[model samples]
Target: MKRFLTLLIAVVIALSAMSTFAENAKTLKIGTDAEPIGFDPHTTPAHASIRIMHQMYETLVELDDDLNVIPELAVSWEQPDDLTYIFKLREGVKFHSGRELKAADVKYSFERILNPDLGALGSTPSYAGNIDKVEVIDDYTVKITLSKITAPFLASMSSIYCSIVDSEAVEANGDLLRADGGTGPYTLGEWVPDNRVTVNRFEDYWLDGYNFENIEFYVISDSSARMSALRTGEVDIIIGDSAMLSIAEAAPNVDVHKIRTRDYITICLNLNMPEFSDVRVRQAISLALDRQEIIDLACDGQAEVSGFAPASMGHWAVDVNEHPLYKQDIEKAKELMKEAGFENGFSVTCTVGLNDHIRNSGTVIQQQLAQIGIDVTVQNKENAQYVDDWKNHDFEMMICQNGAGSDPNRAVAFFFGTGANANIAEYSNARVDELCELGAGTTDVDKRREYYTEAINIILDECPNVTFASPYNYYYASSSLEGYSPTLNRPLDVRNVTKE
Candidate 1:
């Protein structure tokens, strides 16, 4: 009887200790501008969803904090020839769905993204569209062959677009947009649209150092409200702008961090629209708007007046502002408008995202373009509707940020490379396509620069889109949060982060 009583007491004490440990596990809450667009990395375009998906998915290769390619699922890879690469996976990596990750799953993921008829309409497909074949050599080995020799092939795999998923899970469910099939550190827990998204840590995650039990992204659209939440300790961090950086600087307990990014605030013109079809008409619109003034008024003077690529691209970046097309020329714009058969500028709607920067820029652009007799009506739709409209190419002109990277192909090719996956404008130019291909096929920096320069010059004259200001990815976090660092691409890496 005494032995039984002692055993019961011992079990009770162990249970109490376990309960306390579980309660002590960290839960990170972040205040974001918006909720995820969807959970699927291959089908996610906007920043809101990409950030969440990175936490929920794992690519074979991933970008480190320095934007360099580092092995994730793939321990190592070798290129036997210019066109073929063999990847070796680590042991015992498991997906959030069910079973362990295998080479077949990687093959399946590549095939799924490269499938033309799959009708997956996201921008991610382009990163893998060059893949000609994916063959599973064994349970832990896979070989991939590109259609052609490419300079950035290895770095391309580092993109979130190359995330690997469970083949069986995807086969059972057409897509994993709302399902869990990733082998990342975290898996989707619950999501309430336009409200909050919670992702719990994966117990079977192959890598170590993810100490947080779960991470929560609370959607707080209003910048001021997000600041308030940060102040009240409702959120550990917030995606903020230069304005919020000032606020964080003022508060003693808040920490301000900024990543010099290659992102650009641009106006996308749909070519299908008759008004924007004529190159002269597009050029006129581009010439009429003042990018510097827009940057000052809308971006709080926190952005750089740049070309298609941000200045951070260094030698590869184009300074379109140095050319006449980007200079504000009202008379030339009016003359071009008359030549395009619109003597009195036509009316068009400029769709803006649900952010103060975009809204202010759109409004300022509306006033700027009016100088050339163009009638601009600015419109702001709800989050879902706006993303839907942008995806469907339903807008005449949309004001948004163009996500660029350090790669030469990223700035000129991602959207403008003719038949590109993310070419929302449906624009095609044979010369530009040829130049982009030439740029990607070589490792010679000088040769690549010449090719990209020609392409950007043509794009500027053709005016498929107008680049205005280059903005930085600014973050505000509490002092208690440690090990959290943001990359230039704005993908969140919380695996090493801890909350005090």
Candidate 2:
């Protein structure tokens, strides 16, 4: 009896010690790609990097699990006119520096976003493009006046780029933002570029306390390196898709989480240019390769052949019947080429980033196009440089991927509208633009769907872009981890996450 009692006492002591240790733990080890260029929310625009910045800043509004806009910094908002929106800010919120968050700060935040000198306008054009001016009503109230009625205006603000920053912090930072100034759930604790970024939990965050004690982000771009880190217990989580599933499925101590993504890989053809102006040439380009095979080789059988934008995304994804671009017929492609007077295939340069997936897809696409008598010269460039070149219209053909949001209008307006940054294809269709406008303006969901469905049909018929496959996003976590909920539109919400 004494022996059993002693064993029970030992077990209790061990459990007590573990509970105490967990409460006092102050560091979490996370692995990611290279560190962001800067800590400034406006300057760090890369999707991976910006997600980290979002942890340092809070937005006025956020999307819930269902992608519905809910209160975050702003308690509520009202539209007084077609072009004016009034917002009632949350009271008593404080920045990390102990400054009160006010309406002036909100106004300054929008103004900073609109400032041409900030250089963020290019990446977050959607937010700035709609706003004509901002008016401060009081300490906790502000009104945003737009140049025109944009139906998706509030929805656009839910994006990461629209995160509100402390105006005072920006002025003090003067281009190089300090680590610990925002009012997010975590404050930047330490930063070692290309190595690691550490953030400590902010007890005074506007929201309830987050479950994490600390977050440590490590930069490891290689798939093998990340897998090794997870396996060896050097990191607690991996966010990217490369080699995530294989490692998680094989490892006893890791859990793999998958999110259905609207992200799709596209082959963008520059339609405005003379070389690609012919419809036959575009048809030939589409015919040259097997999209399913590319999905198999590039994504390791993890992706789905995208059929006219993802249906799960929202109303703007035109019904498959409305668009015929998803269908692959090599014979039809040949016939179109003949009709366009290109009896002999022409040579064109295909540009792609040197990232893992991009390179893999590019190589497969080159071979596929070659099979259809189209000579494709693949040019590899650094990811950042390639994005710049594509935006500047410097490439004949470019391979790119787009992470679509829950709202289909967000995707349609940014990629299909006139002067859209993603419209590198320079595709201009008056009828398509009209449909897009009608869809965006209507508040009725069914009516909006009808308009977008028509717009998608026009886009498919025009064939401005060729889609290969839609990739799924995968994350790997240590088995000891809990409360790790992954969202399709947002990055890992580390706020509620805990490590055992």
Candidate 3:
């Protein structure tokens, strides 16, 4: 009887210890501008989608904090020739859907990305468009053949757009937009649209040290409100831009991190539009606005005026100061407007989202263009709707940010290259197209930079679209958080982060 009583007491004590440990486990809450644009990274070019998907999906390759290409699902890769590359998949990796990672899955992912019916409508398809075929050599080895020698092909695979999904689970689930079938550090727990997305850490995750048990992404559209949430301890972190940086800096118990990024803001113009189709009109519009002023007003002195290529691209870009067309000249702008027969000004719509910097930029640009007799109408849409409208080419002008790609070649190709998936501007130039092809094929660093410089110079003079400032990406977090660092290309990786 005494032995039984002692055993019961011991079991009770063990249970009490386990309960306390479980209660002590940390939960991370993050505030952002909006929830992911649906859940699939391939379908939407939204950063939110990529950020969340990074936790739920595993790319063959990934970028380290220094923007260096690192192995993820792929243990290593080799290129036997310019056109053919081979990859060896990691062994014993399991997907959230309980499927083992295989070469067939990689082959299917590449094939599905290129399939017209099942492919993404965004830049993912275009990134993999150069692929001739994906051949599965064995259960864990795959060979990818490209149509031509492409410089950014290997680096591009590191993107979230190239995230591998569990083929069997995705097929069974039927709806990929809501399904989570990936081999990432965490798996989707719940999603409430326009509100929050919650993900639980995957116990079977191959990599260790994913300290947090749960991560909740709350969508707070307003920058002030996001900052407020952080201040009140409702959320632990907020991903934002320069505008939110100041507020986070002023708040107590907060730490600010800024990543000097290659992301550039640009006003995309519909080249088919009668007004913008005229080069003089586009050039005049570019001349009217003060890019420096926009940077100061919208970005709170945390950014610089960006040129055709992002300033972060360094030596590869044409110096903005030396570019004649990039300089603002209000008189020249008015004269060009008069030359275009719009001396009395013409009204056009500038569509934007709820982002504070974008909205403020549009308003400031509207006021600036008025000086040159260009009547600008600001149209605010929800983030998803705004992106959809841009994709559908539904607006005369859309204020948008072009992301930094894995390489300079990909970055330049996304905006200036003809038939680029994100080329809402519908910009095309035979010379620029040839330059893009040349840049993609060139291996020498100097040769590649020269090719890009020529393309950037031509685009600057043509004014196909109005390039604005590149704002620094700032993330605010509670001081208690540790091991959190953001990369220029992919910000806010929480896999290794922990809280006190």
Task: Candidate 1: count the clashes.
Answer: 0
Rank the models by TM-score, top first: 3, 1, 2
Residue-wise C-alpha lDDT for candidate 3, range 1-500, written one tens digit per residue: 99999999999999998886565446888998865776675666777777788888878887776657789999999999989989999999998977789999998888777777754643332378788899999999999998877777777887777778888866887646788878988899899988999989999999998888888999998788888888887888898777776677787799988888877788888999888989999999888878889988877878878865676766665567656666889999989989988889899999987467788889889999999887899998887788789778789988887775546666667776777776778889999888878878867878888887787778888887788888888888888788887677556677568876
Number of the top-ranking candidate, with lDDT as the measure: 1
Question: Candidate 2 — worst ten consecutive residues by lDDT sum?
Answer: 119-128
**What C-alpha lDDT values do all the predictions have?**
0.81, 0.73, 0.80
Model 2's lDDT to the true fold?
0.73
All candidates: TM-score = 0.92, 0.87, 0.92
Q: In candidate 3, which residue pairs get closer than 3 Å at backbone N, Cα or C atoms, i.e. clash?
A: none
Question: Between 1 and 3, whose TM-score is larger?
Answer: 3
- What stretches of model 3 exceed 4 Å from their correct place? 1-25, 119-126
Instruction: Summarize candidate 1's per-residue lDDT along 144-228 as a digit string, tens digits.
Output: 9988777777887877777887787677777777777788889999988778899998988877898889889999998989988
Worst 10 residues of 3 by lDDT: 118-127
Models ranked on lDDT = 1, 3, 2
Looking at model 1, report the run of 10 residues with the lowest lDDT sum: 118-127
Candidate 1 TM-score, true structure as reference:
0.92
